[model samples]
Target: MSGTILEMKGICKSFPGVKALQDVDFDLRAGEVHALVGENGAGKSTLMKILSGVYRPDAGEIRLHSKVVSITSPLVAQAHGISIIHQERRLFPALSAAENVFAGRLPRTSAGLVDWERLNRQAKEYLDLLGFQPDVRTPVGELSVANQQLVEIAKALSMNPKIIIMDEPTAPLTDSETEQLFAIIRQLKARHVAVVYISHRLDELRQICDRVTILRDGRRVGHHLVAEVSNSEIVRAMVGREIVERFPKVVAPRGPLVLRVKDLSQKKRLKNISFEIHRGEVVGLAGLVGAGRTELARCLFGVDPFDQGEIEVAGEPRRIRSIQDALKAGIALAVEDRKRQGLVLSMSVRHNVTLASLEKISRLGWLRLGAEQEIVQKQVRDLAVKTPHIDQLVGNLSGGNQQKVVLAKWLAKQFDVLILDEPTIGIDVGSRVELYELINDLAKSGVGILLISSDLPEVLGMSDRILVMREGSLVADLERGEATQELIMQYATGSVDARVERCGR
Candidate 1:
């Protein structure tokens, strides 16, 4: 409801073998939250990068307050009153939270020396506004993922920019932290700061965004007022088709148990965890942040050691003290943080996909090139991964595509059970549907799945059974027929009675 503050016209950018953006147009009005959305590799991030001076557009013109200007670098963009919180964490891991927040703009004393005390106080003030209470002196790497995200928000706000870009800002936050962020956005609106919000979570658009622009295949396809369009319509525009079923959960014949965990306990991270996944069944793991969902996944995958537990794969108790042991036992885990744990970024798609199945493709420790190529080609085609070629670096692909590569690595091998931790996190609606269909297909193929996610609807729609965790303990196990968003939240937050029938105990 205010005058136009920013406009980009005829934006065109290209990468080797990829046309990232093509003549795209976008505009922003002061005091409004405008959303940028699309499927993976749809040019959303590329356009934002251009605007934030991370990449120079091959051809485009930017007008700010009716005057044309060139943004040559991040420092220039900041000087022009622009700041961005990237989807990926960009803070210095070894630096203290306060130091990272005021990296280039640290306050100085009267003598022109570094004012450490004032810097910490100011950083704490910004973090306090977002309801985060980590010690300012602590290194950012020591903080949890959710807390690190809060630090990113605080760092962006320290610049006092006129236009702020948020890319998937809530992917790592809890419900309360997300609400606190919404409160801060409202305050930014009251102060007339324009916000460009980029997220794969379309539902948030209706709640926080004023308008939205949808792109697909490097082109601007649709733009609309948030209130005037349905989420389905937006999905159609982004994917160019009707997603009839977001979760195509097919009920396969439940066979014998494939994975069983009994009396699993860790040092204050997991407490007597017990669960079972039958062949061809999908089990949903639901909980808030810090509920030990990820910790359980890590323990089962042998990324971390457990104090006491028994893991049974196909009725055979096995000791999984390392990742190699877990894989050898037919247990595969698609970790929560794919960028760090699941896939090697510097590796090529061909290499990452076949990294786990080298033994199958090799004989006498000599990898057969023909077998390797055949496996990677099949997976690339089956998953519909949009890459120039299998040789492309995993880091060059979009978030969703990278996630598919992670799954492809595990799928390349024969496994009895698959643990997908946050499989759909930071992924677009269209990509999510593809993943859901893939899950259904995998279940139909008799691979038991353990799905861990914060999206309650995804759990309700895809799982035959839901497991809820609270404070490092399994509290409730509800069948799909009896589970609802409200009930799951109650169990996750411990608002309801914590006593419940423990499955597989």
Candidate 2:
């Protein structure tokens, strides 16, 4: 909102067989949270990397405070008061929160000795300012994903940066955690720090960002003030196409119950959780971070054992003590962390798509390459997964295509219940519409979907029914018509224990 502090003028970057960026110009004003948005392969990351000095631009000049500057490395960028906090948090899990924040740059006492007392005190002050009061001595590994991210922020702020680049910082956060992050960003804004926030969540940009820049296939497309552009317009700018509707939930008449859980309990994570998912129904699981949404999904998928529960598959009680047991009982989990759990990055699309259904694609002890290719090819075409070939490495595909490949695994099987955790977390607009269509088709085909997402609009848009969880308990259940964003948040934050009154209302 004030004078420009950082500017990348006509930047161009390229690699073998790929031009990551092309003549892109970006400017950041002090005290402004400017959004950088695009699809996965649109070079948003590439541009930011150049800004952070990770990669040198092929052709361009960077200006800081209207003066030309050379940033040869990340250290140089930091020296110039530039800090980047990546989506995958860079922290030492074994180290304490304070130690991680001051890992390389810890204060030294007069005699060239470590200053432990000062380190913890300084870290505590930053954490308190951000409204994040985790124990400074606690190992980062012991903290939840949300808290670890907060620690990451504290580390960035310790640099006393003038420019901060936050890449998908809130992808792993829940609603309340996101609010906490926003508060910290506001504090930075008050200090006149410029933030370059890179995310695929457009609504988030509207709320906190002052302006937005869109990139597509290595080229700058459009830049606009947040107040002037609508969400769909932003999508159009980023994707070069209109996203007519974000959610494509076609009415699928409900069928008989396919899964039923009675008194599901998992220590401090889930307490007496019970739910029913019928065939052709999409039940959305909504909650804030640490409200036990992912934990419940893990329990249901047999990734973690439940203390006490009755899991009924098609009216027959079954013991699901392992992942294989869960699969055998016609339950499959498309985990939240797609990069780590859902697919093997090193594997080809064909290999990953056929991973869970290997038995069906192979004979006794012999690999069936033909059957594998055919199945993967069909799935790719059906899901509209944009890939060079079925043999293409999944690691190279976009976020949306990667998610489709994860779904292809389940689509290969005859699973009665599918648990999709944060299915559209990092995907763009057009691909999200495609995914929503796929979800609707799956439900129409009598496949039950238990969608667990931190994206409230996505849940409200696609769910046939919404279930709210808070502090490891199911506090509210409501039909699609009765479930509003305000109502769900109230239940999620424990403002109301209206489970009896709100359930089925």
- Among the numbered candidates, top lDDT falls to 1
Poorly placed runs, candidate 1 (over 4 Å): 356-369
Q: What overall lDDT, based on C-alpha atoms, would model 1 receive against the true structure? A: 0.88
TM-score for each prediction?
0.95, 0.89
In candidate 2, which residue pairs clash?
Answer: none
User: Relative to the unseen true structure, what is the C-alpha lDDT of residue 316 in candidate 2, on a scale of 0 to 100?
Assistant: 83
For candidate 2, give the lDDT.
0.83
> Lowest lDDT 10-mer window, candidate 2?
358-367
* Candidate 2 positional error at 504, Å: 11
lDDT, model 1, position 440: 88
- lDDT against the true structure, per candidate, is 0.88, 0.83
Give the per-residue lDDT digits (tens) of candidate 1, residues 64-130: 9989989889998999899999877799989999999999889999999989999999999999999
